[model samples]
Target chain A: MIYKSLLPIIITLLITMAMLNYLISHVGNEEVKALEVENEYLLTINVFKQLNNTVPKIFQAKACLLISNPINYTCNVIASNITGIIMNALGIISNESSGVVRYEVVDYVIYGINNETIYYVTIKALTPMGDTTGIVGYTYPFNLCYYSQFIKELMNTLNANFTIDVENITVVQSSLGNEIINRVKSLIGTSSINITINIYYVGVFRMINRSINRTTYLGQVSYTARISPNNVHTCNEITTLAGAFYVTAVVNRYVNNTYYFSINGAININSMVINDKTR
Target chain B: MVVVDSLVFPDLVITMILIIIILLLIVYVTNQLIELSMIDYKASMGTYLFLKCQLGNFTIHLNHVIITNGTSSSNYLLICPQLVVNGSQIGAKVYTAYVKW
Candidate 1:
C-alpha cells in the first residue's frame, strides 16, 4: 500500500535531519573556538589600555629604587604592593577598565632591563585556552642614574654657572639647557608634584647589564623643598629640585571614546645619594 | 500494462523526483549554513584587526603625549623623546583617533 512507501521516505527524512543537525553543531563549535582566540586579543589589548603609562613607570620607579638601593623597601613589600594594586583593580578591570573586553589578572613580574624596569603581567581569560601578557613602561635611563645624582650635579652646575640661590631659580638659561633637561621639563606640569622621567628605548635590544657605574662630583647634595601634606598637588616651596617625591596621579578618563592618561608624580627624595662614598 | 504505467509506476517516478529535490535542498541549505558561519568568522576577524590597528595608534599616542607636547595627528605619530631648539618638539602630541578605543 501507499503507507508502506511512506515508511521508507520517513526514515530517509529522519536520517537527513540527523546529519544536518550534526553539521550545524560541528560548525558552531569551530566558530566558538575561533571566537575564543579573538577574545584573547581583545583581552590583551584591554589590559594594555588599562595599565597605560603612569602605572608601569611607578612600579619601575620602585624597581629602580630597589635595584639601585634595596634598603628602602623590601622586595616583599613591593611585591605585596603590586598584588594589592592588581586586586584593587580586579573590579575595575572586569567592569570599568575594559569597556567590553573581559579578562582576569593572574600575576605580574617586575622585569628590569638596561637599568630600566617594565611590568610584564599575566592576564587570564575565562576561555578554554589560558593566560597572556600586556606590558607596562619604564623610568628613564637618566633616572636609573638616580635623582639625587641628577639634582646634585645640576645644582653644582647651577652654582658654578650662576649666582642664583634656591629662591631665584627660574628659566634654566637656554645655554645651560640640553636635550635631557628639556625632555624632563615637558613631562611635569608647571608647579606640579612628582617628577616623571620617560625614556623611549631605541631598540629594546634585549641587551642589558646593570652596574652602579656613575662618576660625578656632587657638592652640597643636601637641599630641602616643602611638600604639601593634604594630597600633594603642588610643591609650594620646592625650589632647586629638593625633597620633591615621585607621586603621579592618572586622570585617565574615557570621554566620548577619547581616552586620556596624564601623570603627575614626585621625584622621590628617599632615593637621595648625597655622599661621594655611598653612590 | 496501462494500469501499471498510470498508477504504481508513475507514482514511483514522482516520489523519486520529490526525494531527489529534498536531498538537493538539504545540500544547498548546508552550504548556506557554512557560508553564514564563514561570514561571521570574517566579521569577527575584521573587528580584531581594527582593534589591532587601534593598539598601534595607542602605543604611538602614548609615547608622544607623555614626553612631547603640542601637535595633533589623525594617523601614526612618531615616537622618540627629544629636545627641539627650533620650535615645538619635533613630534606629534594630540592623536585624533579614527576609531573608538
Candidate 2:
C-alpha cells in the first residue's frame, strides 16, 4: 500500500518538473532576444571604426585625406557593402545601401594623450534596423614626441635660432622629408610608399619681399604620411611633428601608420610676437 | 517479512526498478524540451576597478551579478605600469576591462 502511494507522488513530481521547465523556457526566450537586440544596436554604432581601419587598398589615399573634415569620409563607408572584399566585418547583413553603404558623420574628434591618437567617429547608420547611431574610436599608438628623431631633425632643420625661411619652406620641407624617408627606408619605392607634409599657414596675410606675390602667414604644418602596411614604420618614425613649432595641432595619421606625438613650446606666433621670440 | 510473501517481494523489486527508469526518462525529456526553446540572456560591461578588483562579483546589483572585474596584468613584472593610476582613473592609462555577463 505504501509503494502504491509513493508511485502517485513520483508521477506528480515528474509532471511538476516538466511544467516548470516549459514555463521558464517559454517566458525567457523573448527576454534573451531583447538583450541580443541591444548588443546589436551598440555594435552597429561602433562598426564604423572597423570600416575606417580596413580601408580597401585602392581607396587609401582618398579615404585618409589629410584630416580636413575626415568625418565626411570616416562615416560614409559601411563594411556590409563590400561583400567579398570586406564581407560585413561587423556581420551586418540587413544593412544594405544600393551597393554603397553610407552614414551621416555626426562628429569627429582626435584625442592625443598617453601615447595614442584616438580617431573618434560618431555616425548615424541607416539600415533595415532603421536610423541606428554609433561611434567608432580608432586608435593608433602615437602622440609621444619627446623621444622622436623626427622632431629632433625638424628642429635641426629650423636651426638654433628657430627662423623658418618662409620663401623656401615648401622646397625645404620637401627635401627634408625626402632625406628622412631615405634614412628610414633602405629601399624607397614611389609606388609602395607615399608621404605628404602639409603646412597650414594660420597668420595675417601681408605682402613681404620677393617671397610672395600674395600675402603670407606661417601656419601649422601637419606632417602626415600615408603608408601601406608594407611600409608602415618607415613613415611612422617622424610622425610626431609638434616639437619645435608655434600654433600646432598636428594630425600625424597615415591610417594604421601610427605617428608618435610630441608637443613642446605650444606658443602661437601672432605677427608681433613672432620676430622677437624666434631669435 | 513473512507477512508479504516471496511472490509479493518480486513485485516490490519490479516497482522500484520501474520508478527509477521513469524518473531518469522524465529528467532527460525535460532537459531536451528546455534546451530547444530557451535562449540565455547576455550582457557586457566595461570599467576600471583597481587592485582590489573582484572577478565573478556583481558589477551592478540588479538582482544578478557580472563582467570585466579584474586588474593586474599577468607576470606583474612592470611595477610602474602596474601603479600608473591611483583611486581616480583620470588619465585613462588604466585600461577599462570589458566582459560578457
Candidate 3:
C-alpha cells in the first residue's frame, strides 16, 4: 500500500527533471549566436581603449622631437620607427587582429614667415565596414630655425677667421663643417648607426690678382646629411647661397630628394671679401 | 452508501487535485532555475572572452551552484581543465594575473 502511494511522486520527480534538462538545453542553444555578437563588440571596445592609452604616448614622444628641430629628418625616422615598434607590440598584446590598418601623411605644408613644416598625419586601424578600433592624429610642427642658426654659425666661422684659399677652404669644409654637422646630429638626438655627413661648396671663383670679386660669395654650399638606422640611405641637403657682400642668404633644403623648406637669412657678408691685393 | 459517497469520494478527488498542483509547481521552479543558469553561463562566457582579449593569455574559472527544495545543492565547474605546458603560455609575457573569476 505504501509503495503504490509513493509511485506517483517518484514519476512526477522524473518527469520534472527531464523537462528541466530540455529547457536548459534549449536556452543554451538559443544564446550561442547572441553570445558571439556580444563577444565581438566587447573585444572591439577593449582594443580601442588600449590603443587610446598607448598611441598618444608614442606620438607625444616622437612629436617632442619636432619641438626642438621641426625640419630634422630624424623626426620622420624616429616617428615611423617608434610607431612600428608600438604596432608590433600591440600585435603581440592581442592575437585578435594583427597588422597595420592604414596610415596617411598630409604632405608637409610649409607655413609662417619662419617656414615651419606642418605634417598633418593620421593613422588608423579599421575594417572594410568602416569600423575603426584604433586611431591617432597629429599636427606636427617643424621650424627651420634651428638649421638656419647652424648655417649662420657656419657662415660666421668661414668669414671671421678663415682665409679664402683652396687649402684653407678645404680645411674649413672638412674640419669646421664636420664639427658643425656632428653637433647638429647630436643636438637633434639622431644617434643611430650608418650616418653620413657630406659638406662641399659650389660656385665660380674668378681668382684675379689673387683676389675674390666684390660680387663673389659661396654660390651654393650644401650640407647633405644622411642619417638612417634602417639603411634607407636618404640624403637631406640644406643648400644655402650667400648674396652679394653678405647682404642676405637664401636657404633651400631638399629632403628625400624633394625641395620642401626655404628661408632667407638677414646677415651682412661684406667682410668675406678676399683681396689678395692687400697681401 | 451515503457516507462512502460523501466522505471517501471527496477525499479521493482532493488528493488528485493536490497532486496536480504539486507537479505544476515543480515544473515552474525547475524552469526558473534553468533560466538563472542560462544567464550565469552567458555572463561568464562574455567575461572570459573579454579577459582573453585584454589580458592576452589568462585562465578563467566559473563555479556554478544549483539548489532545490528537497535536494542538496550541487556545484559545477563550467570550463574544462586547461593544462599549462612547459611554463609557456604561447610564449607571451605573463601580463597581470593567471586566473580570474
Candidate 4:
C-alpha cells in the first residue's frame, strides 16, 4: 500500500520537473531574441541622431552667404529660398526612409554673377550602428550637382537673366593634402589667379574612463585670393577684391571611430572688381 | 532500505537537471543583453564635419566640407585673403604648412 502511494507522488514530481525545464528553456530563447532586436533598433536610432547633428553645421555655415546681397535678391530672400530647398529635400528623404536615412552635402558648386566658371564644394556625413562600447560606422558621400545647374536654379527662382551649362562633377580622394593642391593646380594651370587653401582639423572627444577621449573628426577650408586682370602689363594695377568668402565646419563620426575637422576662410580676388571696370 | 534508496536517487537526479537548465538560460540572456547595449551606444554617436569660411567683413557659408588624402606629394596649405575689408576680398598671401601622418 505504501509503495503504491509513493509511486504516484514520484511520477507526479517527474512530470512537474520536465514541464518547468521546457518552459524555462523557451523563455530563455525568447529573451535572447528580444535582446538582439533591441540592440539593432538602438543602433539605428543612434546613427540617425549623429547624422542629424552633423548636417546642420553645413547649413549654418552656408547661411552666412545670405548676408551678402546679390544683384537682384537680398540676403534674407536668398536665405529663405535655400532654406526651403533644404527643408524640402530633408522632408522627402525622411519620408522615403521612414526616418532611417540621413545625409549632408559633401561637395557643391556655385557660379558667379555672369555664370562663367563654377565653384565646387564638398560635404560628408556619417552613419553609426551598435552600442557605445563597440560600434560600426559608415560614411556616406553627398555631391551637389555642377555649378551650372546650381546657377540655373538660382537664376530661375530670382528671374535673373543668367544661363549656364554644367560641364562635369567629380570627387577624387587624396591620400595626402598635396593631392588637393595638385588637383587645383591642374584646374587653374597657368592661370594668373593665385589660389590659396587653408585647411584646419579639429578633434572631437568623448568622456571615457574618467577622461575625455578623442571620438570623431571635423574640418574647415578657406581661401585667400589676389588677382590682377592683366598680369603682364598691370604691375601697378593690383587691387583688393570684394566679396571674399570663408568656410568653417565641424566633423564627427560614430561609425568608424574616426573624426576630422577644419575651419576655412576663403577670399577670391577675381570676385572683386573695381566698380569702374567691366571685364 | 532498498526501496528508500531507489526513491532518493531519482529525486536527486531530477533536481540536478533542473538547476543546470536554469543556469544555461541565465547565461544566454546575459550575453545577449551585453551585445545589444554596446551596439546601441555606438549608433548614438555618428561622424560629421562642420565647415565655415570667413572673408573680409563678409563670410560665405559652406555647410559641409570633406577631405581626402590623395597623393604622396608634398604641398603647402594656404589661406589667402587673410583679411576682408569693406565689401572687397584681400589676400594676406600667407600659407600654413602641414605634413601627412
Candidate 5:
C-alpha cells in the first residue's frame, strides 16, 4: 500500500523537472537574442571609432605640407586629397556586405595664398541609412564634418603668442610703415620656416547670406620681410598702394553637425609691389 | 474498543505524517540540484561565447580580479560563441568566467 501511494508523487516529480528544464532553455534563447543585438551595435561602433581616429592624422599631414610649402599646393589640391583619404578609410573600415560610405566637399575657404600663405577648408561627409545605391547597402546614418580645426588651432596658437597693435596708426606713411614692420619683427622673432606679412588699410564690410557670410576688407600695403631664424640678421621694407582685401567668411552651410565653408576672394597683386630684395 | 481508540488510530496518523514529510524532503533536494546544474550550464555557455566572439576587452572567468584599463563584468549565462575554424562554422563550450577589458 505504501509503494502504491508513492508512485504518483514520483511521476509528478519527473514531470516538474522536465518542465523546468524546458523553461531554462527557453530563457537561454531569449538571452542569446539580446546578446546578438549588443554585438551588432558594438561592431558598428568599432568601425566608426576607427574612422574618426584616422581622419585627423590625414588632415594634420596635409596641413603640415601646406604650411611648409605654400606655393606648391593650392587649396583645391589639398581639399581633393582630404576627400580621397576619407573615402578610402571608410571603404577599408566598413567593407562588410551591408556597409557603405560617401562624402562631398560642401564648402571651403582659401585666403592669403598669394600674399601671406593661409588656406582654410572644411568638408562634410554623409553616411545615409539603407542602400540608396546597390553598391553599399547603408548600415546606418552618420554625418561627419572634417573642418580645418587642426589648422585653425595651429594658427590661433601662433597668433596668441604675438599680438599686433592695430589701434595706433602713425600719420606719416613712412613712419607708419616703420611701426608695422617692427610689429612683424616682434611677432616673428627667431622662429618659423619663413615669414610674410601684408598690412592692408582696406575698408571692411560684412555680407550676411542664408548659408554663409563673409567679411570683405579691401586695402593695400606693400610690405615684405626676410628674417633669419638665428635672429642675427633681420631686414624688412615697406611700400604703398596695393589693392588687397582680407576676406573672412563662413561660406558653407552646416548639415547634421557637419559644416561647409566656401572661401573666395580676389586681390590685384600688381597694385602693391614688394621689392624683390624682400623676397 | 479501547485498543482501536488509543493505539490503532494513533499509529495510522503518525505514519501518514511521516510519509508527507519524506515527500517534501525529496522535492526540495531535487529542486536544489536542478538549480545548481543550471548555474553550471550558464557558466560554460558564457565562456564559450566570450572566447568565440573575440570581442575587444571582454573576458569571462568564474572568479574576480582587479584590472586597470577598461570595463569588465561577470556573466552567468551565454550563448556559445561562434567561430570560423578551417573555413567552417564551429560552436564551443567554455567555463564560467569574469570578463574584464
Candidate 6:
C-alpha cells in the first residue's frame, strides 16, 4: 500500500527533472546564438569604419599626383614630391624607384554648372636605374580615366584635395625574365586609380629537397624599403613623382647536382602616373 | 513463515533492479551535461583570447611568452616591431633573441 501511494510522486519528480534539463539546454543554445550574432555584427561594423577612413586619404594623394606637372622631374625629385603629398594627405609611403618611365592620365565627361568638360591629361616620366645599366620599361594605359572620376567623387565627399587616375600604364622588361615582367604588369593591371605599392629587392637562393630524387630546392627572396619612403610628404611628392621606380631582382637556376643561384640584382625601373585632369 | 520469506526476497530484488537502472540513467545524463559545459567553457576562452590578441603590444608579449615559450625554452625568437599606420603594419623588423631554459 505504501509503494502504490509513492509511485505517482516518484513519476512526477522524474518528469520535472527531465523538463528542467530541457529548459536549461534550450536557454544555453539561445545564448550561444546571440553571442555569435553579436560577434559577426561587430566585425562587420569595424571593417566598414576602416574603409570609410582610408578611401578619402588615398583619393587626395592621388589627385595631387594627377594635377602635378612632370616635365624636368627627375626620379628623385618625383619621389620626394610624392612623399610630401602623401604626408600631407595622411598616407603612408611604401616604396619608390627613380629609374623607370611612368605615365598616367584620365579622360572623363564632367557635368558641372550646366557644362560638360571632356578633358584628358597625361603625365609621362622616365628615370635611370643604377649607373645606366638597369632595365627600363614604360606603362601607358588609357582606361584609367574612369577610375579617376570615382576618386574625385570620393575626395569631394571627404572634403579632400588629392586624386589619382590611371590613363595608360605599360611595363616592359629588357634584362629581367618574362615571368617577372609579367608579374609586375599584372599587379599594375589590378589597380583602379590610386597607386599604392611595395617594391621588394629580391634575390634567388636555392636549397636541396629530398623528395624529388636527386636534389630539389626552394628559392629565397628578401625585400627592404627603409630608405624609400618614411614620411608622407616625401613619399607622395618625390617617390611617386619619379614616375618610374627601379628595384633589384635575382634568378636561380639548377642543373644536375650543382646548385646555381644567379645574382641578378640589376636595376630595373618602371613608371606609372596620371597624365591629365579636368577640374 | 514461508510467506514472509518469499515476500522479503521479491522486495529486495525489485529494489536492487530499480537502483541499478536509476544509477545508469544518472551517469549518462551527468556525463553529457559535463561534456557540453566543457565545450562552452572552451568556446568562451577562445573568444576572450582572440580579443586579447588584438591589443597589439599585449598580444605580442603574450604570444612571446606562451605561444613561443621563450621564457623557459632554448629557441630563437624573432620579433617584428612595426607601427600600425592606416591599419597596416609598416617598418617591421625580424630580430632574433635566444632564450635559455
- Per-candidate Cα RMSD to the true structure, in Å, reads 22.2, 19.7, 15.7, 29.7, 20.5, 27.1
Q: Tell me the tens digit of each residue's lDDT in model 2 across A3-88.
A: 67667767776787777667667755654455434333423433443344443321233223322222222322322112222222
Determine which window of 10 residues in candidate 6 chain A has minimal summed lDDT.
A92-101
The estimated TM-scores of all candidates read: 0.35, 0.29, 0.36, 0.23, 0.32, 0.31
Off by over 4 Å in 3: A1-4, A29-38, A74-79, A95-279, B1-101
Query: Considering every candidate listed, which one attains the maximal TM-score?
Result: 3
Residue B45 lDDT in candidate 5: 52
Q: Rate the local accuracy (lDDT) of all candidates.
A: 0.37, 0.35, 0.37, 0.31, 0.36, 0.33
> Which docking class does model 5 fall in?
incorrect
Q: Candidate 5: lDDT over CA atoms?
A: 0.36
Cα RMSD (Å) between model 3 and the true structure? 15.7
Report the lDDT of model 5 for residue A275. 33
> Which of candidates 4 and 6 reaches a greater DockQ?
6
User: What is the C-alpha DockQ of each candidate?
Assistant: 0.02, 0.04, 0.07, 0.01, 0.03, 0.03
Interface RMSD of each: 11.6, 14.0, 12.2, 16.3, 11.8, 11.3
DockQ of 6: 0.03
Per-candidate clashes, comma-separated: 14, 7, 3, 78, 14, 63
What fraction of native interface contacts is shared by candidate 6? 0.00
Q: In model 2, what lDDT does residue A153 have?
A: 47
User: Would you give the TM-score of chain B in model 1?
Assistant: 0.47
TM-score of 4: 0.23
Q: Which candidate has the top score in DockQ? A: 3
Q: Which stretches of candidate 4 lie over 4 Å from their true place?
A: A62-279, B1-101
In angstroms, how far off is A239's CA in candidate 3? 18
lDDT of 6 by residue, A98-178 (tens): 112122211112111211112211222211211111111111222223333433332232222111111211111233334
**Interface DockQ of candidate 2:** 0.04
Candidate 4 lDDT over A109-142, as tens digits, reads 3433331222332323222333332221221121
User: Which tens-of-lDDT digit does each residue in A1-279 have in candidate 3?
Assistant: 333474587577768777776776776666654554443443344444544445444544444443333334344554455455444443443332222122222222222223232322233434322443334333323332334344344445434322232233223234444444444444334311222223333322221222332221242333232221112212233234332221111212111221222222222211112112122
- Which ranges of candidate 5 are over 4 A from the true structure? A1-10, A71-83, A93-279, B1-101
